[model samples]
Structures are given as C-alpha cells and as structure tokens.
Target: MQDKSKEAAILRSWHKNVEPWTRAVRESEIRSRVAVSDAAIVNAIIAQSPKHVLDLGCGEGWLVRALADLGVTAEGVDAVAGLIDRAQQRGGTFSVMSYEEFAAGAWQQAVDCVVCNFSLLGHQLVEDVLAAIATLINEKGRCVIQTLHPAYSGEPYCDGWREGSWQGFSEDFSDPAPWYFRTLATWLAMFKGCGLQLEELIEPLNAESGSPASIIFVLSGSSRK
Candidate 1:
C-alpha cells in the first residue's frame, strides 16, 4: 500500500480502537510500557527541564497528566476525537488535531519541549510535521521521540512499511494499522532535515529480556546546547 494509504489506516485504526486503547493505557496493560518505555520517555522529557511542553499525538492525555503532577505546564493534541474526549474528561488542555493540521500551523502555542511517544506513524506527513514543530519551540527547546527500535523490526534493516499488530493486546483491540518503519539513520536524517540535532540517543532496556524496549531520540534545534 501507498504511504498515504497506510497513514490513513493508522488513523482509522486509532479511531476504531479508542476505547480499548484508552483502557489498555489506563490499566497499564502493555508490558513494555509498564516495564520500561513509559518512565523512559517521561524521564527523558524531565531531563530537558522544559517550562512548557506539548505532547503531539497525545492519546488519552496520560503524559500531560503525568507532567502536570511534576508542575510542568503541558498540553496535548491528537487526531482522534474519541481519544480527545476521554482526555478532556480526565481534565487538561487537549484538542482533536491531526498531524497534517498541526503541520499546517493549526496550533499557535509554542513550548520549550515537544514529545511524540510512539505516535509518529506516517511518511511525508511525519517529515512535514517535524518541520512545523521546529518553528513551534523556543530557542532552548527540545523534541523527544520514543519509538520501537529499528533493529527490532524483524524485517529487512531498511526503511519501509510494516504490518502493525495487536498481538499482545486484548481481543477487544482490532484494526491494527501498518506503520512506516524508519532505521536509525533515517531518523537522524529526518531530524537534521527539520533543523534539529541529536542531543542524545537513549535505548531503554527491558528487564525481562535484557533488550531495548524502545529508542528515545532527544533532539534540539541546531543552536541549542
């Protein structure tokens, strides 16, 4: 399938599985998340010492809530209305906005940090969105992204589409969307193209397997220290 088609399927899958997704997150059903990735991403963000933060592709606003507890002013945005509704119900600033809309400059608010936690799953639009985010941060800002390590893709070690799955998830979840997998090199290149520099590359380990649970890219504007 085409990149755009796969991207569309991703959004559709999210829209269709909002309930189960929310339940899974709230209950901490995902083992990797419960074991490593969640705190990994959160700690990565806190290390940035951001005054204001934006959680792009923020699902049910869990990160926002977590950051708020630490006294950070954080706002969230997601494309799925159902997810946004659930997020708002829990109380925080969240809007239903697609990455395309964000790339088009829908939200005017700028922040010291921007985060994408396993939410970036597109191609051209992903590049465009990063470009847009580049302009929406302060000079001393950072953009942190945590995603599945490319080395664990179990496919050819190159950039391409891979079938997504709800394999470890409950039976209630369905409509898994195919995601565009990017190698570490591609990820670094994309960041550079967006005028961002890699400040750190973190591989959070999964205790059970002693393997990396996810890879976190800590990036900042070229001028940022």
Candidate 2:
C-alpha cells in the first residue's frame, strides 16, 4: 500500500508546474472540447435533480463552478494546493486535501452525488477511492467518473494523431506518478465490486481530432436500506 500522504505530495508538485501550461492549452483548444463533454454529463445529472454534489479530484473546480451556475450546491476537493487556490479564486468552494483524508472525516456520508472528471486515474489506490466514493453517496445517489480510454493510454502525450489515428507510443511524458490503465471491462468490474451499478458509459469523441479518447461513466449505488 502506497502512503497516501507521499502520493499527494508528488501529485501536488507535478500539478503545480504542469497546471499553468495545461491551463493555457485548455484555453486554446482543449477547453471547448472539455466543456462540450462535461456539459453533457452535468446536464444529464441536473435532469435527475442533484442537490448536493461533490466534485472529487476537481482541478481548478471547473465542474463546481458549472454546477453552481445551474443552482446546485457543490464543493470540490483536490490535493494540489495551487489548483485548489485557483479554484478558490474562481469562486468555487474547494479544499486542498486528498480524497482519502476527506473520506475519512465528517464528509464521508454527506454528499448526494460525487463526480470525478478525468482526475481519478493515475492513482494507485483507485479501488480505495471508489469505496470511499460509495460511502459518500446517499441512498440512490449518483456518481460520475471519467478517464482516458485505454486505447489512448500508451500513446505519446504530445503527438496529436489527427483525432482518430491510433498513434503508437512516441514518448511517455505522463507524470511519473503511477497510473492504472484498465480496459472498459476492468473499469466496470471495479465499480461493481465496490457496490455501484453502472448507469451509463459515454465514450467521447475528441472534438479537434475526432477520435475517441475519453470515457465517462454514470453510476448509482445500491440502496443503503
């Protein structure tokens, strides 16, 4: 078992430097693509009447801001202090803390919905995180998770393959942080084992490249009663 504290520190350092560059890239072309995909997922959950939502691993609290715009009470948590600071500056209620720490505290059983948008991957303790998320959801509550498609996992981080072409590995620039690249089957099985039933799975087409590189999952927990 990796020490959660050590993992958090490493991730924080990685993001502290990378986030500025990422934010710029996001603003250029990535933001619009992410907005389209996230908007779809957020809209679907809003239709279901979400009241209290938790945005886990929320980088800069984009989803939290969006949910607040839609009149939902939302809070975001992330391990990167710089990102959390940026999120706060954007008017998001965010805390700089690891999910493991938060889940072990008073907020464990309090949220109505939990959403992890493209941030839960690369963690060594994914199962533990899923279990923690399950505990956070109220009965019949929902959970949403998104990750890079396994087909895209091994690709070079910088080589944009015209959207659909599967480019083989060129350079592994992924953060040295450990990541689990699971197939769709493995993703489903892990969630099922944690007692959440799959509600929907969406493979998003990259707007610029027109390739499928992201997978979104909507899940519901078993009734607590």
Candidate 3:
C-alpha cells in the first residue's frame, strides 16, 4: 500500500513539474547531469552502436533527441502527457505511455538498446519494467541505466524507500517524489532475476569532488549464459 502511494506520488510530482523539469533539462541546470551523468549514459548507449533505441521513462526526450542527432532511431515514452507533448514539439519521436503499459508489452518493436537514465523510480514496478526491457531488446542488445550510486544513499546501506527532494535545484521544482533505494547487491540480484547480465558498471565522477556522481549499469540479455 505504501509503495503504491509513493509510486502515485511520483506521477503526480512529474505532472506538476513538467514546466520546471523541462526547463531544467533544456538549460542544463542540474550540475551532476551537466558535469557527468548525462554524457556517461549517452556514451554508454552509443558504445553499443544500437540501430533503434527506446528511451523508457524519458522525461522531455533530450536523450532521444541526442541519440537521433547521432543517427540512431530513438523513440521516447513517458507517463506524463505534458512531457511527451514537449518532447514532440522539440523534435524526436515520443509517446505518452506509463511504465505499467510498457511493462505489459505496449511497445511491440524489439530494439537494440533501451535506456533508463535516472528514471527507474518504482519498487516492484521497476522490476517489471526491467524484465520487459530484457525481453524487448534483441539478444545482442543492451540496457543502459544511469542513477545515483548506492554509496550516495549515505548510510544504513540496505534496500528500502527514500524520500526525494530538489534541494539543489531552483525554487520552481516542488512536490518531490519519494524513490526506492537499492543496495549494490540487491541491484545485481534484481538484474539477474530479470534475466539481464551485467556487462559493465561505470562510475562517472564529479571533477570537483572526485567522487562518483552516478553509476551506469550496462546490461545485456542473459540467454547466452
């Protein structure tokens, strides 16, 4: 029940934050994103040299636009209609679809890559989405995920729920959504459970602090095992 409400709160927060969120991405307001995670996730996906990529939970579709510019056929889907509208207006193919819809196999085409860039925010729902992604990609395909490292969670390192906030951002952002946190071991176990094998774990660093700004997990279908 708690998980369900937190999940719903996430959607509500995004719905209310479309404008500020879009502006932040467009203006590169987030320091961590501007400094490292954005390039890290993009480079990780490009390394696979995918032909068609799906940007799951893609907010305003900056990643889609970026990949499209690099000649990849990229499509983005978001639960928020406003974000999808903004994404379409800005360029790139986008649709309004929730993670539940996606996990239920809403997207029929098999792609070479699927990226969830700091977008996997649910509990069991995220597990469902990961399983869907594993089956949605070709055998040789990969799923690139960029998210805050477990170490950054700052203590009592175990799997649980955590409240999210927009402390460092501008005043416009509000209704901060709560997010589920997973420790490193739990993360790996979840991937394995979803039939995804970890290909690489990249820790993109912040130049100033020299600590990892975020972690990138490069995973591939585990059928080869």
Candidate 4:
C-alpha cells in the first residue's frame, strides 16, 4: 500500500512546480498533436450517450470543456488545488480532492460515466482511484481510462515509479512526480478489482510516428466473480 500523505505531497509538488505546463494544457486545442486519444475518448463517450460524466484527475478540465460540445454534462475532480482553480477559471465545475478522500466517500454525486484520462498515476493511487470509481457510478455507468502504452514502458524506456522533470512531452515544463508503470495484465487486473468488466480496449496509434501513442480501456460495472 502507498501512503496517501506522500502521494498528496507529490501531487502538490507537481501542481506547484508546473504552472506553465497546466497553462499550456488548458489553452491547447482539442486536436493538439500531443492529445494522444482525445478524439477517441470523446467519441467513445458520445457513443455511450451518458447524461452526466465525471472526469477524475482532470487536469485543467480540458476534457470537461470538450465533452460539453457533445451535450454531456461533466464535472472534474483533482488533488491539485492550483489545477482545480485554473480549471474553474475556464468555466468548468471542478473540485480540489484526492483519491484517498474520494475512496473514503467524500463525493456524493454518482455519475453516468467516469473518465480517468492520463491522470491516473502511481501504483497504489491507481488502485485506490479505481476502487473509488466503483462506488461513484450508477448501475449502468462506464469507466474510460487512457494511459501510456505498456509496450512503450520499462528500463531505458522510463518505466516504474520514477521522479524527474517533464521530459517526454516537451522541454518547456518542469515538475517531478512518481509515475508508477504497470503492465497490461496489472492494469486489467486493477480494473477487475474495481468490479469493472472490460467492454472494449483501444490502442490509439500516432499518425506521424506510426506506433501506438496510448492505450484506452472502456469498462462497465459487472457482477461476475
């Protein structure tokens, strides 16, 4: 098990250390090249026709803004207050909250769908967040998770829980957070632990690089044991 206090401190550091990073993401267009699976995610959510959606760990609430175009009402929650504040400045309904608090029943609003995006980081935090989501959704709700491809992680490839400045996306930002790299099996198992069944999985390929840019999992609540 990972310490919530430690993860909370790390999250604050990430938000405190990266003001410009959040700004860039907040101002970025929906179709930015760095947006690995924004289109796919939005499409998937639209296809589901969810009335109310939840954006867990939604940094700056870009997805919340985009989802509005499809007429799907959404709210966002993040551990970083600065990020939440910035997201609110953009006319988004965001709350400054953490996974630990959420799992402990902080938020009472159950949603029709939940999207984790690429913000689900850390080993224990990931499982904790998934477990929280399980109790925060309606009976037929879905979970949309987009994360770095398992095939593109590891030694010499920047895998596991390591701390460093933001280097993969660009050299413009500076922030260090412990990112837990999990295998495909581990990710699927975590979803199962949350009482979610994998309905679909998509590997979004980068058009320019000709390789998978990220992995997206579409899941729904299940009673199967």
Ranking by TM-score: 3, 1, 4, 2
- Per-candidate clashes come to 0, 1, 0, 0
Worst 10 residues of 2 by lDDT: 161-170
TM-score of 2: 0.76
Model 1, TM vs. native: 0.97
TM per prediction:
0.97, 0.76, 0.98, 0.87
Q: What does the lDDT read for residue 56 in candidate 4?
A: 86
Candidate 4 regions with alpha-carbon error over 4 angstroms: 1-9, 27-35, 154-159, 168-172
Residue pairs of candidate 2 with colliding backbone atoms: 163-209
lDDT of 3 by residue, 25-141 (tens): 999999889888889988999999999999999999999999988999999999999999999998878999999999899998999999999999889999999999999889789
| Overall lDDT per candidate, in order of appearance | 0.92, 0.68, 0.92, 0.76
In Å, residue 155's CA in model 3 sits off its true spot by: 4.7
Where's the lowest-lDDT run of ten residues in candidate 1?
152-161
**Which of 2 and 3 is the better model by TM-score?**
3
> Candidate 1: which pairs clash?
none
Model 4 lDDT-worst window of ten: 26-35
RMSD in angstroms between candidate 2 and the native structure over all alpha carbons: 6.0
